[model samples]
Target: MFFTPFFKMLLHKKYILYLRVFTSLVINRTFIPMTRRFLWLLTCCIVLLSACDKRMVTADNPPETNNPTTGAPPISDKKVQAGVQGIVTDANNDPLAGARVVCGDQNTITDQYGAFRFQEVNMTEAAAVVTVQKAGYFNGIRTFRVTAPGRDQFVQVQLLPKTTAGTFDATAGGVVAASNAQFIFVPNQVLDAANKPYKGQATLSYAFINPESNDFADIMPGDLRAVNDKNELVALQSFGMMALELQGATGEKLHPDGTNSVTFRMVIPATLRKTAPAVIPLWHFNESTGLWEQEGSAEKMGDSYVGTVKHFSFWNCDAQFPMVNFKAVFKDDKNNPLAYTAIQLTRNNNSSSYGYTDEAGEVSGLVPANEQVTISVKDQCGKIIFSKNAGPWSTDANAGTFNVSIDPDARLALSGKVTTCDGAAVTKGLVNIQVNGVHYETAIQNGNYATSILRCATGAATVVLNPIDETADKMSTSTFQLAPGNYTRDLQACDVIQVSTISLLLEGQTTTFTSPADSVLFTSYRSDTSTVSIYSLSAAQKTPGGLIRINIQLSGIQTGPSVSRYFTVAMNDGTYFSESLNITITRTGIAGEYLEGTFSGNVQKIPGNTTAPVSGSFKVRIE
Candidate 1:
């Protein structure tokens, strides 16, 4: 141990330079005399210095870590893949085909059944936002939690039609009322599309959504989930909601300036009036994010909740509640997944939320925490297929799989083949079925259609089938009374007509309209005369000061198909009218059922002497 202190010094990383100098002196025989013990000690010191260097290097650069079981990177660091599927419908619960749906970076269009799916979407957040857009309706949005990876969630969005409530001049703002909702606009507060002050006549379109309505679950924008002022996701109990929009005289979009606020008064439903909070948070729908964000607060005055907003879109008076993630899977008695089925969750306070099952029969969303809720699965006909009480979960949890036993006597399966008038298979079509006042629709594939319906009624069930042939543009109607069981039948698109469609071509543009979005009337007079009136008002013309209006009036003596009659076209509140022209009238084989025809002529603007050539076709149901 002659060089014990020197060995210790060499082991210290900070003394490496001194160790190098000592080793160099020893090698040159200047620091110490040569000896076997000294050489051995030098060897030991070198070994210890190497070991200390290795320890410092290891501390700076550690080995890569792996999962103990998988021997790969941890799963928590990887991106998760989840899927979403759903349906889009109108306020009447009718499917909206060709609607555009978007979620995150994925986008798709709805099929004939209003169904859409996005598979294997990359998700990194706890929730996902979905938005739906279709012409002639307001935008539909939903935000739900993505509870698990590799799982598909379903959402149903119902779009409300855009309707004008009232109008006022932008220079002298006034009040407008729609149903139980009232709006107050301040003078010189309206801004046009360019964000400049607008001085023209303004049209106000509004809709007051009553949360107690049967269609509230479908018609509401979101699942009552919102982000509070603290940026925390929470559930909401809505008192009422109002959707508003303002447009200038020439159809330019308008909104209130940031410096000025618009006053809103929403009447709470009688059922919820007693429980309505005196002051509640006001949230506005964010179209880009498809989520509601807290903006301000509203106060209750009598039966109405009044609030002021800086701009316009959708405003709601809602009370917030703590929430936790909920998930479950549903299966039939045979262990088959109950895919694309409706599921509803009703809170103890009567407030409700809804979701649909995906292809795997799985549904997930945020629910109120520590509260009792009743979950019900319903068939297309609105019959409850299964019901159960689910608990007050204090944390995120899955309720596991639920097996539903459907009564065989309550199930109705219908399968059939559809053909065109010439006995050719109708490749593209729709099978619309109506039972017990509820409508169900399915797409036709290669002339074959099949669907299962669940009915709770006993005895014979009355069913109405309306098959449409897209290939030949034809349709047929049939009714049957049968017991609840599987049945096979064939349908032909022949004489029975049940459609109201019209198309007008003026100049180089074609404007096509379809009912029940448009109004087409067929009135028969007692004097052996009949008249067909077709009226279509665009979204702009639904308000005052709108300049464009399309109307067609047909009148003639009693005549059948292929007979040409006199008709006139009017525009802009009869400011312009077409000179008398020839139009053919045809009965659709069934008396008092429908009228079909075509027309071509010139429309002249009164006092201006401007005439435009117009041609169009129509197929209208008799009223």
Candidate 2:
């Protein structure tokens, strides 16, 4: 056995060279061994040295800090936390709202603008994987590298619509074909959730992803990174890919039994047919990890590659290539970091990977080593803003900072102030702006908002602004047309009338209450039930000292007028309840709109106590 100190000494280049010379002398019999034990030790050292020399550490393939047996990266002891922001869109570039997005153990749903954000997320590797799922669409995924903790990384995902390829009876399996992809199922092999053979009909939802497509980078799952059978991380050059899902008649997931396999075939794109390899590895995407794992192999036969898979998800026929870490930063002409911009790197084989710059305008990933590549920056509309040919780099490299000029006609700068109908500043809110189908949102701080957007050319653009007030739980929308240039506007949230007043007469004394100070809320739960609440607090009182609240519950109300059956008044004096209350909902608005109504009633101090007159009128917006 080799001692630890001796093994460490042999790791040095000089020591290794000395050992090689000593071994040569021993083999040539020029140096006589003192003992048989010495000869055996030399033999062991020679074997170990030969094994070390097998891993050539050249300029192209630098020494890796990885396990010798498994090519996996060393496990880090430091915990890393990062911030992530992203958007999910469909094939038409339309924002997909309500999509479920998952990153690590944290998950969130996209807002109406198709945007989601995670303030702080734990990251185990240098990269983060985000997955998105929506009804009627295939899963969308993105894997991007991060530089450090507390930095925000952005990614854009586009989901493909799941198209029905064909259907077949599980008992009588058949083939399903879509575009240039095909799936062959075996009879009595399909299993449902319960691990039992499914005898009913099975519907296949499939999508064939062409590497030559313009949106390939946006719609493709992961970053084309995979773990091979040897546990080595490598980049993939795809000839083509196919995503498939099998579902039972009741929309339950179904898959082929492990005992039998399903054959899948994908036709190589015309552009990549010449470079397609005779035999390539087959990789299936692991949605949970957002990484591809090699499972089988496919052999190129004529124009198509055929392989068999035990299950169904996303399968690719890709040629694996060794990679080196690469990084680059982008800036505008004025030397400002271009945050959240789209960047693409295309290999000589036409296979490309895309990523977005972080808040610092930096992007890092693994790229094929010692190969010429073309790097380009694209706008949100998928238009290339800048492109250049770079590298044949050997080892890990930083391409340095790139500066690009933005076309004046494609630049938009907007600044605005948000206010309530009373002209008071909105302290806590968000301003969501949509221009030419792309959404950009900024927080409203101190009632002011500002953002600059870069996009493709549009002669005249229509801009829509949706401002939300969180304090009052109100939202309003406005739209206008403008040309690319810097503009400022002060917006008033008038969609929900802000001025609401209520007058109450009790014991021959009339008290007036106004909103914007007192709280007036209108909530419509369903078509039949609604609620109007008015809460008032005295400035000099603390806690529950001087508080008054009135709750009115209305039933059988629609968009028009209706009467309420329940009303309650809670104050410092006592609690009063009333059964007969008249509430007229003059107008009921839809989403992002307002609700206006008025109420009047008489309440008793208690259910069967002295009566008091209570009448109030309110025209307030629903929160």
Candidate 3:
């Protein structure tokens, strides 16, 4: 323990040197392997000495430290921290669950209640760019600020429904243009997915550019001119593609019905003939697929090409092809050429090209080509006179000649009078005529009506008379067949009738009866030509547990036999009532005073047409 001063000083100096060497080696990466053992020994000695020295560092001067493996930059802590919470909803305030809410780098999905919250979000700026999105809804964005920590900032967002904004209607018969390019927009039907009319306002536009024009340049919407009550715009330039945009057209609008339409007109410049000699093809830009799809071919209008569309979007016509002329001759059964006939060339998808035959029985026009094509000729009445499959058409070999003969006696004219079984015309009703499942509606006038249909050689044809009034009578239906010719028949439209079979053949005949069970008077009206008595019966009967009342009204003159509406109670002592049913009545003569008609559609407590058969006739004395 006791040592010389020189030896002790020497030992102290060596320890200091070892400590300095070990500390320097630990801090730097340049130490060699040869000094590794010696450095380890120095480190152990320094640790023991440090405990004895009791050394410490203040917070103001901390030791330097760094990561050992990655050599990456140190992460920085944000100075301000905040949170955001909100709900996403539709225009009606209905919650939109599973909506994606994004703010800065933090994103959270909405819960079932459409609520979303971001915890411990680091604020980057004064306002956070918050976005909310959901399927079938417009994307919503809001610039929101978070003032306080947790649960302080809240937002409620409402998204509108996307729908069609406008319609493009192409004119039916466009004016032929002599220019090379033409633009036309015809408003077809605008309807929702359910085929309802589109109620909201929409903006429609088109871009007309030469085929060589730049597609990147933007075209502003042109001024719209009102033609009558319709939205129409005459083309300001000869050509370019147009983009359509809609504003304030969200909510409940997707499809539109036929009543919604507009016509767009574009004038073809004189230079169009040299630039685009072929017909103009209509093009629609597909947003989903990012491609141009052909909608239909346009009809040539004077200095323009016109076409109709049911929606508003980017539309144009730049793609073109050469036109080819196809000639067809139409004739009758005896080889006699027909004039002014409509000839149609149809493709597989039902795209049609039409032309009219001239006095020489020849129809020649430029027609487009498709894979599977067919040619057909029709008379002026829209009845097909001849049909042939002309499929696998080539645009290269577009010109051809064909001769067709059709039977002239292939159509029929059907004329009839709708009356009740008692020979009274149904004046205040509609006659629904159906042939082969096709329906045509005609209003009943003067108890007489007429409708045309394709003559069917087999199966029965049906005629139904539906009254458009308030009465308890039933709808009347009749069934028959016809040959190719003009014919007239009297139809009886009424509910099922149950009555005593008595054919009275003379005039001035009267029949009266009183219900034994209900004490209701049934008085019949008669005509001088028939024995049928049109009766007026009304009664308040109490059966089936409730009191029921019936009423019928008629004041007129008649030429044919007439029958009265019977208030027949299907249940014992009970009557059916409806506010929308009516019976039939027909009158012929001076001032239509004599009355006759049949009755159907009765609201027996069930509130619909009854099958019960009832008939009657009545005559009012001429004063």
lDDT (C-alpha, whole model) for all candidates: 0.66, 0.69, 0.40
Model 3 lDDT tens row, 306-346 = 44443455456444332333555565543434443456666
Clashes of each: 0, 0, 89
lDDT of 1 by residue, 570-596 (tens): 344546445655566654433225667
Ten-residue stretch with the least lDDT total in model 3: 220-229
lDDT of 2 by residue, 134-172 (tens): 889998988767766777788889899989988877775
Give residue 572's lDDT in candidate 3 (0 to 100). 29
Q: Candidate 1 vs candidate 3: which has greater TM-score?
A: 1
Question: Candidate 2: what lDDT?
Answer: 0.69
Best-performing candidate as measured by TM-score? 2
Compute the lDDT of residue 594 as modeled in candidate 3.
34
Q: TM-score, each model?
A: 0.55, 0.61, 0.22
